[model samples]
Target chain A: MSAVLRVQDLSVAFHTRGGVVRALDRVGFSLGAGETMALVGESGSGKSVTAYAIMGLLEAAGRVTGGQAWLGETDLLAADLSRIRGRRVAMIFQNPRAALNPIRAVGAQIADVLRRHGGASRFNAGARAIEALRAVGIPDPARRAKAYPFELSGGMCQRVMIAIAVAANPELLIADEPTTGLDVTTQAVVMDLIQAMAARTGMATILITHDLALAAERAQRIAVMHAGHVVEEADTATLLAQPRHPYTARLIAATPTAAGSLDDLQSVPGGLPDLRRDDTPPCRYAARCERRLASCDGALSVRALAPGHQVACTNPLEAAA
Target chain B: MRAILLRLVGAIPTLFGVVLVTFLLTRVLPGDTATYFAGPTASPESIAQIRTSLGLDRPLPEQFWRYLVDLGHGDLGMSLTTGQPVKTELVNRLPASAELTLCGLLLAIGIAVPLGVLAAVRQGSLIDHACRVVATAGVSLPVFFTGLLLVYVFYFLLGWSPAPLGRLDAFASAPKQHTGFYLVDTLWAGDFETFRAAAAQIILPAGTLALFALAPIARITRASMLAVLGSEFIRTARASGLSGPTVVLTYALRNALLPVVTVLGMVFSFLLGANVLVEKVFAWPGIGSYAIEALIASDYAPVQGFVLTMAVLYVLLNLAIDLVNRAIDPRARRGA
Candidate 1:
């Protein structure tokens, strides 16, 4: 399938009093029709930053220094705020509790999206809002539409957020930590709802999260990020069975699998390199790599491990290749 | 509901605060009504007789007790200047003040809310910046100045003066004065021309008070709205395909109103208290000017009545604010 949303070399940066923080450095990824791609990373690893850039929801302080988010023919980064805000791209945020308006009813929030993009009148818009709520498997959608955000559970609120993001039927949906704050069961249900909706609508989704196991199960492809770079990208099965980059191997080993004990599950050592200094290298994961060769310091570039899988490093760990 | 009750209970202190300050402040303002009324050179015996009869010779506590007891019976005290009962004076003047305050508050809210909302929606933009300048000017300039400016515009420039200065027209002789308000009285006069003229005269004063009120309320409203707009829910609402107004009205402005409601109560009480100056500026015979004349004449009844009424007004305004707060935030009701 053609790429529903193609993000090419999108790098976001923050200029501060201290120095420029290269939050996202030449990070590239894409989402195709009905496919789920998880951008997994730790906090401050440019996971949420990349999602914000994709959805065009970056705060005033941050800027998309170099990038383009394509929604069909429209370039979202270049689109006017009013045009992009309601119609083309939609986003679901972390902390479902804070993501919804407390004063407004959930159904009304969904209907709001529909009304703005669907050209529905007040009556029809509300009907469609209820329909969107029902689509996300919310029971008694009409009655539930009148209920305030606080009245509902966290799971319900996140579902409401999903319903809102999907209501306009945008080709691209950026689910930014859609289940971060939710309980385990609620997380499963939310992920299922997101996947089901994406599949039904044939919309591309970039699910930014920190949960590797969940990403493994839900994502068609997983883009493992380290510091501010996409260190490895591949189909989930291939990446899991034969991980290439050292960071990706460390991440898989770090996953809390029932097959491994605490001693076997080792975390990657050392902290991420600070990108403030001018000497910061293209290979951000080089500091944490076990097999750091002399040639590793050269301009690290992407080398294809497979037809569709790419790894960004001068030296790959022996086990993954 | 419990919070509302608690708020009502708290109102006692507010009422006491109003009466105490009004009473004490008027007393200590370096002017004595007894001396003002008796004149610079009067017989000591006549002064003593006047003091005793006026209950001034009684102990301070006894005097305060008498004032409260009379107040409970709805007797504010008589205006020494007019020989009218203080209750009668309040009853007579209340409608005019109420009319002016009500209109002024409505006018203030009408202007302030929209202006504040517009400024908030487009913060740092031209409309927002211009309104900021206007609000600063509105708040910085005194009510007296605003009233004078309005008079200059309406009376001097436009030649559209209100029926003299008083609330009622001198010619109405007021066929029916049940409402105690001039507009109501004029309506009862069955004379639209007189009513229209009375309303016209009332408008300038009311409008002046409103503009003075508008400044702070606008500034507060804009600040509150800016904060709400910055909240995550507003961002969520926008991302949900909601229009600017929908997100603002449903998500942003409704939440912002919590602070605005509080200020509204204060503004209501403030406008009532400030009406005295406003009435004087407009040359209208409202409670403010009445209190001054009564204070000078040692008309203890009317002054006490005015202070007591002002106290009650302040307390009641707080109560209204509590109820409004409970109504807007569902969580507050649960907490209560």
Candidate 2:
């Protein structure tokens, strides 16, 4: 399948009072048409930063230093995103209620996006917004459209957010921890809604999440990140079954499976290296890797063990099962 | 609408409290109303008869009962100094003060809201710095001092204003009374010359009040806008590809308006109080001067009537603000 988004060597730096914090460093990933890829990591892992940079939604203090985010023919990092942001690529953020305008009606919010990118006229935007709401499986979407974000449940708000995101039928969608504050059942429902919408539109999805189990269940491919680097990338089955990188193995061990008890979970030891330090090592996970070698101090490179599995480490873990 | 009606009904007790406080406080003031009205060389018998005729011989509670009854009948008694009914005196003078306060407040909002929003949007820019300076200067300087400075610059030095006079210039006469707001009445009377003269006469005092009112309004707007700008919804709005102006003006500004409007209500009441000094400086014939003149002679009726009018106006203003707030914010409609 042809790729819809190909990000290369994306680096983002935030200028703070202390020093420049390299939030994302040479992070790269790609998604093919209709493909669902999850960028999974812990907090401060640059997953959301990469998403924001691609969407041109980074704060004033942060800027893309070096990167090329090619959305087909256009370089997203360089293009005027005002026209492309909601039209060609859209996003649904964490905290669905906070992500929506509190004072505006949910339907008006949807209509705003529809008119902006969906090519709906003023008179037709309201009706088209109701249709968009109905597409997300909202009950009585007509009345629900007039309801404010504060009036809706968290799951319903997420669904409204999804409706707004997919209003233009964009070619790419970035969901940045879209189910963070929702309940477990609502999480599944919202994730299912996103998957169903992506399938209907054939839009490429970049799901940024910290839940490894969620990534395993929903994403076809997964990219594991630590600090600011994409440390490993592979098909979800291969990565989960025979994780090559030690960090990926530790991540899998950290997850609570159906059969695994509380005592069976193993956490990855040590914290992420300070990205602000100028003398920090190239391989951010090497300091925490038990399999770290002297060579790990040198330049880190991606080593492909199988046809579709790649890991960035000097000493890799052998395939399990 | 029900909310407005409720608020109106609720305001009655507050107005009554104001009336009660004003009545008692005026009674406690130094110098005697009967003595002052009776004159210096009056005989003891004449003074006694005068006191009796003026209802001063009645006990406090009875006097209060009579006052309340008169108030229920829309009578504010009579001003000893002017020999006119206090209600009629207040009715004639209130419009000038109302016109001045309204003009000042409108001017302050028109300038400060945009200035504050711009300062927040282009934070740390020269415009922001200028707004800070303007706000600080407005807040620090006294209203009377600013009034005098304006009169000095525009009337004495620059020759742009009429003499720091009352409502009209020597050449222009008062227009027919429709709204009692000279700007409205002159326009209604098709007297462009008087309108221009009225505008000129009002410019200094209103500007003085506007300068004072704008400081807090601009500061609050800037603070509120800064907060709204940092919220997640703003980033969401930007991600949704709404135009920069739409996101800032419509989304950001509307969210910022609640606090700004709240501050506006406070600033308005403050402006009314500040109007007294401004009115005194400009020699304007408004209720502020009327009350101050009555207070000096210890003529209790006009002073009491003045406080009552202000209290009623404040209650009504608060109701107006509540309605405006409801219109601006739906959350407020739910009483949230």
Best by lDDT: 2
**Model 1 TM-score, 2 decimals:** 0.87
lDDT accuracy of residue B235 in candidate 2: 88
Q: Deviation in angstroms for B152 in model 1?
A: 5.8
Clashing pairs in 2: none
Task: Looking at model 1, give its docking quality level.
Answer: medium
lDDT of 1 by residue, B1-336 (tens): 566678678777777676666666655666555656677897787778778888778877787777778766766666767877777767667777888888899898998898899898877789788777878787787888888888888888888775346765565455366677767766777767767777777888898888778877998899999998888887787666576677778788899999999889878877887788888888787777888777766566677678778877777777777778878877666566
Each candidate's fnat, in order? 0.57, 0.75
Model 2, residue A144: distance off in Å is: 1.8
Give the clashing residue pairs of candidate 1, or none: B77-B86, B77-B301, B78-B86, B162-B201, B276-B288
lDDT of 2 by residue, A60-127 (tens): 99999997899999999879999998889999999999999999999999999998888899999999
Candidate 1 RMSD to the correct structure: 3.6
